[model samples]
Target: MLGLGAPELILIILAILLLFGYKKLPDASRSLGRSLRIFKGEMKGMKDDDVRSKDPARTTPVRGEIVAPADPAAELEAEARAAELRAAELRAQAERSRTADGPR
Candidate 1:
């Protein structure tokens, strides 16, 4: 991908690993994954909205009107999961800072 050969890709991967270090890599990856998931969901929702707009029976809401999610329980669960991820990230960050401070 991106015109990078195997060796070049390996070198780039190694550079990223060294830059971030092994300890923080997982956290970075987890955040990236969450971001990708959110983006993917948004894209899917946009496509669904496009399809809905094309339908003759469905009326679009007026501007400034609130839109509720199709599944409120699922929305709440996703929010709870996000909060958990944020909390975990904060704890990891605090631990990293504490270790880096070292006997001060």
Candidate 2:
């Protein structure tokens, strides 16, 4: 609908036909249609899930061990410490390797 007229549409169609030969066009269109159908189905399922989530009675209760509340700052600090440890370990390994390879 980008203000394209019949002639422009025809030209575009011709270009597509030229790009993808007629024999393959049908298969491509079929694949595209199937993808679109699957996408629509997924979108519908997501919307249904959202609706179910909004309705407490329709939602499933947690069955496993309850998870603790997230602590963003503490989690980040822990991750940073782990990364620092890994970096130190790598540096030590590299230093050992370099010393072993020295004068060789």
Candidate 3:
């Protein structure tokens, strides 16, 4: 497409074949096809969800009188806790890796 003619395309394909080898190309292609299919399916699902959200009747009705609107302070506090947990997990992972690598 990007100013690439048939010869350029052929050259690129040949290069890829050389890099990956013919024996593995089919498996790689299958994996790529499956990834594309999954991507398309997720995109379609998001679009359907968007459409459903736009229709009021599609959503569940509130069970009772709505409480006061959500507090931003509480949300921020929850987010901060989640971030701390993630950081702790990452630190643990790094420690494990360092131990496994054995004083390198």
Instruction: Report, for every candidate in turn, its global Cα lDDT versus the true structure.
Output: 0.92, 0.92, 0.91
Regions more than 4 Å wrong, model 3: 61-104
Candidate 1 TM-score over all chains jointly: 0.55
Q: Candidate 2 on 1-104: residue-level lDDT in tens?
A: 48999999999999999999999999999999999999999999999999999997666758984655468889999999999999999999999999999966
What TM-score goes with each of the models? 0.55, 0.58, 0.56
Error of 2 at 47 (Å): 0.6
CA lDDT for candidate 3: 0.91
lDDT of 1 by residue, 1-104 (tens): 38989899899999999999999999999999999999999999999989989996565768997767678999999999999999999999999999999977
Stretch of 10 with least lDDT, candidate 3: 60-69
Please state the error at residue 73 of candidate 3 in Å.
44
Model 2 spans with C-alpha error above 4 angstroms: 63-104
lDDT at 23, model 2? 100
- Cα displacement (angstroms), candidate 3, residue 8, comes to 0.5
Error of 2 at 82 (Å): 51
lDDT tens string, model 3, 27-88? 99999999999999999999999998899856545898455535889989999999999999
